[model samples]
Target: MIKVKGLTRAYGSFIAVDDISFECRPGTVTGFLGPNGAGKTTTMRVMVGLTPATHGDVTIGGLHYRDIPNPGRHVGVLLDASAQHAGRTGREVLEIGARTMGLPGVRVDEMLDLVSLDGREAKRRVRNYSLGMRQRLGIAHALLGDPSVLILDEPANGLDPAGIRWMRGLLKGYADQGGTVFLSSHLLHEVEQIADEMILIGNGRIVARGTRDELLRDATGGVFTTLVTALDNHQLAEALTERGLVVHQAGEGLRVTAEPVDVGRIAADKQIVLTDLRAGHEGGLEDLFLELTAETQRDVLPNDMSADEVRA
Candidate 1:
């Protein structure tokens, strides 16, 4: 498990990571989420001892990263995939990692194959490899030692759809085997699909942290947003309003704030002919992330700008 206590990092007076604290437990995937330059990279760097902390400390299994014997065998980290030796072959990169961890050469081939970098791909020099290939190579090396903890930054940045799916399964299986996985990624859907818990950060501070259900529950407002239509629109709208439910006209239908069960019951009671009905939770991870980090957001759609405005 990874425990961070009052972790803070500063360059002179420019504070990058505030007094933040969190834990990445074993047998689960904890997603570190934030906008660009939100101190996620700094936190991960502090975790691996790549950067000295201004205050507090991060530990892996009750010991500092540098204090751990054969740290690679205990914690695997991939801060920058492109940091690999450009002149070295893909296989060579993993070979060096395996050697440092006192692993056999066979482990290099195994990892290369595990990440689908075998044959010609593995033989190619790192400089010749594409961004996606480098990401795969970095992942292979991180897993080369079969470490108990994994720390990755933007692991899915350059992966395609299929590669992303494969990575999801790989981390899930690793966690199932009692390994800890803490990763940062901009792919909200991937994080939503794979993470057992999530930590949201903004402006160098942790704004929110919880399991998906726990966090989404707070964002959902306990109200289901539903779209429904019936044969008699005027009659249905009047009946719904009289029943004390808020309804509004929405593109050939009505957007109502009510549970699907309640809506169906009301329709059945009124003997209305329903043509369509769909219910969904209006807010999700994207919505929550935006809300928490809106002030820190650097890029945004202009309030009065659209395709029409741009063409004018």
Candidate 2:
């Protein structure tokens, strides 16, 4: 288990991470999510003892990282995939890492296979590798010590579709095997699919933390949305209102808050020439996250859309 209390980091007059607290249980994948400058990297660094905290404590199994006996043996961290020697092969990097931690070279080879980079490419210099391959090398190195807790920052940054799928399964498998996985990522869809719980931070402070459904419920305020495209938006809106459904006009259609099945049945009964009728699938995580973490202040994650575009 990992526990953080009053965790904070400051640089001069700027607060990067502020009094954030959360506990990650054993045997679960917990996603740490936030906008770009929400201090995720800083927090991770503090957790691993790479950076000292300003005014808080972070512990692994009731012991601080630095106080733990052989911290590397209990915590495997993959913070920067780019922090590798370009001249060394992927296999060589892990071998060195393992040796530094008093682990055998065979453990390095095992990690290479575990990350699916055991083939000929593992022997090639890291300088010749692509972004995705480099990420795999980093994972392999992190797994060298056989730690029970894995802390990764943006593990999916450079992965292709197949690699991403493989990584998802691997992380899930680790949790199933009673390992605790704490990872940070910008991919909301992937987190929704894989994370058992999440901690959301904004402007250097934790704004929300809970199961995916719990966050969704809080963000939506229990309002439901449905899309109804009919030949007659006017008639549809009127009928829905008459039936005590909160209805409004959208683009070229009507959006209703009535039960989806009931709305469909109503349309069918009126013979309303429906063009497109569907219910919203719990507003996308991307949308809810954007709304919860307003873009007015600090740096946000590099979304595909610009701030102005997101606002529009």
Candidate 3:
């Protein structure tokens, strides 16, 4: 439903977004992930024409957002959580959002209810709302137009665990109904739970993009961890080594990286009498994301520090 082709944006001599391309399919929630200053916001701005790209283009339903009539009705954007007027009540803020999109004023109230902000706080001024409340308000505004595409940056910021879960369900439901939802977030655990695919950027370039499973497979080569509990760890290790498999001692159990069935057969052949046999997999999205972005930072930063410093 959304396509970005070689999108590039530069600020003076520094490139805020490098040549990058990706697709957000319908009936799926594609996550936009990057470390700080990785051009996630810049890319989103360019996509919506909020910030002009130096090169390349992005389109929704095959038409540039700028070329579409009432683009607000076709795409709902929640980039800045503090974009609303501080003086406006929550309901009023949503009303303005609805009206701005040429939608009905009732949509404001309906969205407020839809986001579960109905009775108690609708009349309260936005300035009086807590950070979590403001997040909900931002989501309410994004949903006001009932647009088919949603581009949200940090929609879960300041939300409690329950609120985050609700947001996840809401986005999932939207995509399940064939809507396109592109969410940008720094929370790896959250993205791991909800996103069907992920696009990870660093130094303004897309370093990785694929399904979570695909990324794990690509970065880790289908590696699996086998934990073997046996009385003679040395014999089991020798048996596995004789089979040309790598083995390492981990606590009382020997950790072997090999096929699950192969490890079991080796233990049987060696008469290891395994009491506990467990299987594991390598790096999750969090691990792959870290590895990719870390390498990018090391290559891009002015000084040769570490990833933690770049993040700091």
Candidate 4:
């Protein structure tokens, strides 16, 4: 298990991570999500000892990462897929890692196969490998030790849809077999699909953390928004307001803070002809993510802005 308590990282006057605390337990995948520069990478680096924490602590299995013997054998990490030696072949990369961990040579073949990097592909120089292939090679190296805990950053960045699906299943199976997986990504849908729990961060602090359903429940506050359109839109709106439901004009319909069934019942009682009625969570987790991180998200330039103004 990974435990972080009041973890904070500072660079002079600028604070990168601020007093954040969370846990990644065994047999579960914890997704650390945030917009760019929200401190997700800094926190992960501190956890693995690449960066020093200005305050607080992080421990893996009750021991700091630096204190662990041959930490890679216990905690597999792939912070940057491109950080591997560019002069070596993909096979050479895993061979070095396996040798450092005192694993047999056959372990290299196993990992290459596990990540689906064929013998021919493995022999290719790291510099010649595409971003997607580099990612695969990096994953192969991370799993080469068969560690109990894996920490990856944006593992799906260069993967295609099929590769992403493969990775999702691979991590799911790893956690199912009692390993801990702590990965960070900005890909909302992929994380929503595979993460057992999620930690959302913005402006160097955690905004929310919980299971997908739990976060959605908290965001909606037990009141789901329903979109409805009726032949007599004015009558339907009045009836919904009379029933104590908050209603808003949405296009040619009404958006209400009530369930579809409840809205249907209200329309039925008012003898209104309904044209449409459905829950308004079509955006799913993406909506909640954007809402919580709105302040941190970068503003798009106005379309009318001149090129010189944009550069300026």
Candidate 5:
């Protein structure tokens, strides 16, 4: 398990991570999420002892990363996929790591094959590998030692759809076999599918952390939005309102604060000539993610719309 309490990292007078506390438990995948400059990378760096924490502590199984013996055998980390020697082949990189970790040279072939890097690809120089291939090589390096815990940042950044699915299954199986996986990524959909728990950070602080369902429940405020559209859209809106359901204009349709079944039945009884009908999420992670982290974002749109406006 990984434990962090009151963790902070500062550079000169600039603070990158601020008093964040969380845990990545054994046998679970914890997704660390945030936008650019939200401190996700900094926190991971601190966890692996690449950057010293200005205050507080982060430990893996009750020991600081620096204190761990032959740390790669205990905690695998891949903060940057391109940090390897560009002139070296993928096989050579893994060979060095395997030797450093005291693993048999045969493990090199095993890892390359496990990550689906064929003999031809393995022999290619790291500089010639595309971003996706580099990512695969990096993951292979992380898993080469078969450590108890894995900490990776942006591991899915350059993967294709199939590659992403492959990675998801690999990590899921690893966790099922009792390994700890703490990874950070900007791929929210992938994270939503793979992560057992999630931590959201903004402006150097942890803003939210929980299972997807738990965060969605709290985000929607115990209600849901139903989208409805018909030949007579205005009439459909009125009928929904008369049924004691809150209705609001949602773009070309209407959004009702009720169940999809209720909307369907009401439309059927009213003979409203339904054109489109669907239930909004119980609470969407994307909406909550945007709402919670909007403050830390630097991008500005002249006509930026809120989640409600976008829903409309």
Candidate 6:
């Protein structure tokens, strides 16, 4: 397990990470999520000893990373995929890692196969490899030691859809076999699909952290948003509003703040013909994320700005 207690990192007057505490347990995939420059990378760097923490501590299995013997054999990390030696081939890179860990050379071949890098491709120089291929090679190197814990930052950044799916399966299987996986990403959908727990950060502090259902439950406060449409959407909207439920025009339907049954009962009492009604929690995570991090999000236009002003 990975434990971070009151972890903080500051550069002179600028604080990069601020008193954040969390845990990444074994046999689970924990996603660290945030917008760019939200201190996710700095926290990861402090956890692995690349940067000094101004306060608090981080430990893996009750020991600091620097204190662990041959830490790579116990904790696998791939913070930057492009940090590999450009002069070396992919195979050569893994070979060096395996040799440093005192593993047999065949272990490198196994990892290459595991990551779907064919023998021909493995012989290609790192400089010639595309970003996607570099990510694959980096993953191969991270898993080469078969460590119990893996820490990866934005592993899906350059991957195609199929490659992303493959990565999800691979990490899921690894956690299933009792490995701890701590992944970081700015993409909501990618983390939502695979993370067992999520930590959302903004402005150097944690805004929220929990399982998907738990976070959504807290955000909605037990009141679910329902989407409904009827033959007369205007009538349905008026009826819902009359019932003191918040209603908004949403894509040819009315988004109401009430249960489906409540909306249905109102529609029936109003003699309205309903066409569609369903719980609208599918986008709850995205909505909650945007709401919580609205101030930290980049390049957002002012709501009061006119279209002509924006064009100007």
RMSD of 3: 5.4
Q: How close is every model to the real structure, measured as TM-score?
A: 0.84, 0.79, 0.79, 0.81, 0.82, 0.84
Write model 4 residue lDDT over 165-217, tens digit each, in one string: 99999999999999999999987888988899999999899999999878877
lDDT value, residue 144 of candidate 5: 90
Question: What lDDT is reached at residue 90 by model 3?
Answer: 91
lDDT of 3 at 77: 88
In model 3, pairs of residues that clash are none
Better of 2 and 5 by lDDT: 5
Clashes per model (N, Cα, C within 3 A): 0, 2, 0, 0, 1, 0
Off by over 4 Å in 3: 226-279, 295-312
Residue-level lDDT of model 2, residues 212-250, one tens digit each, is 867766766766678888888888887778789988778
lDDT of 5 by residue, 208-236 (tens): 89998788777888687788888998888
Clash pairs of candidate 5? 251-312
Model 1, range 1-312, lDDT digits (tens) per residue?
Answer: 999999999998888999999999999999999989889999999898889999998999999999999988888899999999999999888888888889999998889889999789998999999888999999998999899999999999888989999999999999999999999975667897889999998888999999987777778865566788999988888888989999999999988888777888889999999998876554566898889988778877788788787778
What TM-score, to 2 decimals, does candidate 4 have?
0.81
- Select the stronger candidate by lDDT from 4 and 6: 6
lDDT of each: 0.89, 0.85, 0.85, 0.91, 0.90, 0.93
Q: Mind giving the per-residue lDDT tens digits that candidate 3 earns over 67-115?
A: 9888777788899877778998998887777777788777777788777
Kindly provide the TM-score of model 6 when superposed on the true structure, using C-alpha atoms.
0.84
* Span of 10 residues, lowest total lDDT, candidate 3: 295-304
Give every collision pair in model 4. none
Output the worst ten-in-a-row residue range by lDDT, candidate 4: 279-288
Q: Which stretches of candidate 1 lie over 4 Å from their true place?
A: 225-279, 302-307
lDDT for model 1: 0.89
